[model samples]
Target: MPSAHRERRRVTWWVALPAALALMAVVLGLLLLVAWLRLLPDALDPFGTRTEDRTGPALLESIQDMSRYEAASGNFQVVVDLDKDAKFLPDAVRGSRTLFVGAGTVGAHVDLGGLGEDAVTVTEDRKSATVTLPRARLGRAALDADRSYAVAKERGLLDRLGDVFSDNPNDEREVHRLAVRHIEEAARESDLTDRAERNTRTMLENLIRSLGYERITVRFAPPSG
Candidate 1:
């Protein structure tokens, strides 16, 4: 009976030894895995999700011919603070405020296409020439999407909920339009047109000089009221 009891105890020890080693191995493997994950970069996480663009190819749009010469371009930037609030309602319930930084470019052009037959006058001896051109005009403001962005946004609880349900949440068209408007106004107030006219005059003078015209006079038409 003593021998049989000792044999049973030995058998139980052998079984428990393998089980303990297996549990230790499993814990060590888990620790190693956690360390490896910690060392990995956030962008390279194995369990992280990724986004893809499944948009279709672009379509062909109509093209138009351009004859005007772009003489000068001016870059502009503005800060736009836009706010909306519901009448008689608290700001927390139904209000929104956004601060946007807008960057854009406005170009001035000379419309050579509008020149008529009588636009240029020359001396009878062909020793000099006088050219008349329309005053330079400002082109449309082109916003740089890469440089323009929203600096801050604050939306009420109701407004935040609307974003979750709306198809085009937090649409920026209004802000973009306002920024373009401001840029256009600034361009109009600046001397971009005068610079453009001066550049155009210089260009025409050089060209006319190359044609052996000793005296060249460039005149721009007055801006119509």
Candidate 2:
């Protein structure tokens, strides 16, 4: 009986050490887990958030605020019809598009501030003067939102579906851009620059005549290349 009791005691003593060591391991593991959790970032998931910087919008705003002095303005209207088809598929239209009727104004200008000391010539008596002005050039084109509008629009199934997952330019800004482009082209082709030069000549002639000068010569400088 005493031998049986001693054998049981020995078995219990052996089991007790392993159980205590396992409990210590478990506690240490819990502490390590708490320390690891503290090292994680505050914003883990990027869902439903914008990660891009805001430099683009700010740049567009700066562009819109700039202006230049314009001498003559030409008003024009054009129909902007565009169609985009899938690049790999048949020629049938199947993509996003920007279509509109656009009305805008283009201006021509001459930088009078660039005139040199020889641009104006005066007689010794200050009775009459001859002035030469700089050549006229095209200015920034502007779109009138009140007169510009979308005529029609058709989007492909794929493009419409992709709108939900991506960022794309809408019709308004692109339409205005198209209008400005065409207006600038037309202004370059038209006689707006000549008209600007003529207008400047007439204005200077009148101003000199009003200053008691009987003869005033106002000429535009030859166009620069």
Candidate 3:
């Protein structure tokens, strides 16, 4: 009788101990979850607001500031020809010209010199507009166009090689090697036209920014031919 009683007591304690521990663990987990939920708003607000809420207003202010600067300087001739295709425009013009300003400073400086008349072309519909800007008009912004161009040229070479040997990984590597060889050959063959173009583009962008036109828009014309 005594032994059986002791065994029964041990069994009860074992079962009770595990059950209590499990209950306590569950309670602790719930409390932690509640605390996290309460703190989430305060902790996440800054990052969330910076990425989603502040972007639009910030961009608008930048555009406005740039526009004001341009207006005050009164030194630019913004020519937007609505009779050309957008496809032929230079990459720089397509990318940088989209920035719209209403009244404040820009986060990044723009290099507008790469903008060219040759880049202006008509769209398929002929109803849109295209722009042709002079190199002098782009030099007013803060970014260094020459450096950008050099970087672009280097990346462009790699990108071209990637396009050529996209099917086979081994072929891709070989193509890259061949491309490098060709680039070296070309550089040895001439007076570094790539570098010259970069420098020229940078100078043009700086000149444009120096002038008072903050923003330039070119709507493309529909293509007739």
Candidate 4:
């Protein structure tokens, strides 16, 4: 009986006792990890996801859906000075002259929204492509109010007297308009349209080349009314 009890004690010390202690340690570690994670306020994703697969058809549709493609634009700067003389009486009697100077900018652009289905053509072997685009044109000019300012202005005695009793405001708005008009006129006379056409051609050629075409031909159709 004594020998049997000794053998049982040895087995517990070497195998069963160590196994039970290891199992308890594993459970304790798991419990501590759970508690630590619960202390954090936000849940965290272990795996980072950033990109997705993009298909060719989806990309093509997006390009076709564009309503306007600005091939090129020019920012034309100008300074303008204007004056107007006013009088309540005959020519030299108590007349007022307004001399004002202002500066501003305008833009010239091209339109490509008129491209039709027949505009693009690809060869049978897909080695070459021809793209027809509309001629470049100027769009509505925009004024950069932040960049524009009145350089100088002066109102004569008659004008100041008229303003004291009249509800009419100063002619600053009109002066600004004239400055913008001058910029537009100057841009019209420049080679902005020609530059836009050349840029458009280069852009189409590069785009077609990116699509695996060895040779690309770009042409501009006659302008439409």
Candidate 5:
């Protein structure tokens, strides 16, 4: 009888210990969850749930404008008229420049009207030459405003945390910002002559396609007369 009682007590303790541990773990988890909720009350509303509908119209307009000018969805064009007396040659091309715009996911293209078909003719003085570019071969750029906003939002939160926690935001935001900054910097770093060239090319290609221009020609003139 005594041995049986001891065995039963041992078994009860083994079961009770696990149950108690489990209960403690569950309680801790709940507390952590509550704490997290307190920190980011809007976390459950991830898709801008609290955003006001009043801004809908404005947002749409902004989106439209961005899509047209900064985004890659609309047409972009620019024209650079050179002096008639200017002589542009192959060597003069070194100092030529172009402009670019960021439109949308597809990016910005170059302006075709700025470069005429006869612009590429090399002159005897090697002073200047016209270069015509087709719109189809232009490059496009991608932009992610939402990603950038998320990063800025996350960074704002970290700043409020008083330097105790690491200020790491979502990876998407970082990537988006890096890409935007890189393109902007590139535009600034490139020579003035070529600065607008990439953008112009992209724009011309998009415009030609949309306008049904099977063959589009642009002309460039010498800057110095």
Candidate 6:
């Protein structure tokens, strides 16, 4: 019985020895692989990741012909301070304020599409001509989203809670609207229209000169109500 037990023990040891060796070999191979990956450049890695763009194609929208001549564009920057307070409530309970820096551009254009048949008058010899154009007007203010930013924001306890549950919590549309209005007002106060008129006149004069017109007169029509 003793001899039989010794034989069984020897067999078990032989089986476990090979299993342990195989496990050690596997562990050594994994360590070597990790070391190689770390030491080698990513370009030589067989398991390196690849980048691909899977974005969908862009859809084209409606297109309109441009008839107005954009003569001048003014860049504007403004600091906006907007406050919202609940009626009959203290600011600590229900109030919000934002300090934002906004940037935008306003364009002045001459509407050549409104010209009538009598807008241009030429002498019989065609040596001189007079061209009338509509007064330069300002276009919509285009806000620069990349350059505009919020400097600071303050919200009351209730306002904070509302933002936490609101779907459009960070909506800055009101502030943007105010900024645009302010920019438009500034543009109106500026001489951008006068500059646009001068530029348009220069362009027309050059064009008429190229056409062999010795004398060219450019006039702007009165602004209609």
> Best-fitting candidate, measured by lDDT?
6
Q: Count the backbone clashes (under 3 Å) in each candidate.
A: 0, 0, 47, 0, 40, 0
Candidate 5 structure, TM-score to reference: 0.24
Candidate 6 lDDT score at position 120:
97
Assess each prediction's global lDDT (C-alpha) against the native.
Answer: 0.91, 0.77, 0.38, 0.69, 0.44, 0.92
Per residue, candidate 1 scores C-alpha lDDT tens digits across 33-147 of 8657776565855544579999999998988788888999999999989999999899999999989899999999999997999999999988799999999999999999999
CA shift at 13, candidate 3, in angstroms? 2.6
TM-score leader: 1
| Model 1 Cα RMSD, 1 decimal | 6.4
lDDT string for model 2 (91-191, tens) is 33357566788888888877777778998899989888999877888877888889988877677777767777977765567767777888888889999
Candidate 4 lDDT over 1-225, as tens digits, reads 999999999987888877889999998787667656664233342222347678656344344555555656667666666655553554343443444444444434456676678989998999989988777777755777777776665656665677789856446667667766777787788788788888878877888899899999998888666
Between candidates 4 and 6, the one scoring higher on lDDT is: 6
Give residue 6's lDDT in candidate 3 (0 to 100). Answer: 100
Give candidate 1 regions above 4 Å deviation. Answer: 1-38, 41-44, 167-170
Colliding pairs, model 4: none
Deviation of model 4 at 88, angstroms: 8.4
TM-score-based ranking = 1, 6, 2, 4, 5, 3
Q: What is the TM-score of each candidate against the true structure?
A: 0.79, 0.64, 0.20, 0.60, 0.24, 0.74
Candidate 3, after superposition: displacement of residue 158 in Å?
Answer: 31
lDDT digits (tens) for residues 113-186 of candidate 5: 45445645445654433346533222434554432232122222323363356544443444444555555454
The worst-scoring run of ten residues by lDDT in candidate 4 lies at: 40-49
The per-prediction CA RMSD against the true structure, in angstroms, equals: 6.4, 12.5, 21.6, 24.4, 19.3, 7.8
The stretch of ten residues in a row with the least summed lDDT in candidate 2 is 40-49
